[model samples]
Target: MTVASLEYNGKPVVAEELTPEAFKKFGYVISPKDQAPKIPEGTYGMAYRLSDASIPVNNYGNSEFKTEAPCAFNLQRFKPPKALDRENKVYNLPNVERHPYTTQTFFPMGVDAEKAAYLVVVCENDENKLPDLSTLRVFVARGNQSVTYGAAVWHGGTCSLIDQLDMTMFMYDNGVKADEVHLVETSGLRIEYHL
Candidate 1:
């Protein structure tokens, strides 16, 4: 796992030069609507809601993103403390509970789209430091203020600092929603963090 820290002092975060051609094998695609389109396959799409009441604008390019309800807040970096059991060794499913379908909006690419991807942007408001993920490659912005991942890049869930962070993300590859979410018991199946 690699860890990088991004500090902010009222400066803009510049996008890194990530060309689609460089990640062709990983299914990269450029969205026509994006001025700097470099969508990666099977990745998450991160964007601030344009229609938010707190920050609304008519223009797509220059408009400010609004942070409002139906939003996900206060998330931590996702890192599996241990690995799962092998396929054959598994039997019944793990404790699978259905959480409420959140009203929060997330960027979703065509799961069936030949080239799918997902993305997450690290934009914190209070100058909080970013977390580290094991074996994950994060293409950070020039100033280390933020970063966007490519398609199908293996990752964990929400861990954003601020409510509104301007970002262009993509989701790629096939998806699944099975009845059971399984996890096999292992020695180091837990991760401890100090807040």
Candidate 2:
């Protein structure tokens, strides 16, 4: 058995609308729509949402991420699996990971709002500090959105749908051990969806 379980109960997990209210536990939804009605003016009127994101790292528990870790920016390319691109409807959740010391953000680039999409699969930690399967939740994030995985939260991989997607990700890192913790589960994670 893996560190978690899923509800493949025949009907898929319907990647419904994502809301910051419901998603606060895992992280936050960072889209223009989620921004306050009035964009706060800064030193320059052009600056946008500069102070909106959660602090890059949590400085609690004597965490080194604050003083020793450098905020790393990376570009990621993701595509649907060969077996389940635009033709198929089901996706398997093969793995999950957590960045214990820092919050991670993903911003899709040049994606068409109508055609590109991805799933956000996340869950809370169990009493034993592992991913709690019963709490798993999946949200559909489209081209206009960005997601931030809170520090120490467990979440799935890219899981994009339809066409290929490119993303810019930001996170704090030490380049070893504190980078990420992963769980690779081979079965029992069939996610059904329709493009």
Top lDDT model:
2
| lDDT by residue for model 1 (45-163), tens | 66333232112111112213322222223323322112212222111111111111111122332222222122222211122223212212212111122222322222233322222
How good is model 2 by TM-score?
0.78
**TM-score to true structure, per model:** 0.22, 0.78
lDDT, residue 184, candidate 1: 19
Q: What stretches of model 2 exceed 4 Å from their correct place?
A: 1-12, 36-50, 58-67, 82-85, 184-186
Task: State the weakest 10-residue window (summed lDDT) of model 2.
Answer: 1-10
Using TM-score as the measure, which candidate wins?
2
- Separately for all candidates shown, the number of backbone clashes (residues 3 or more apart, or on different chains) is 21, 0
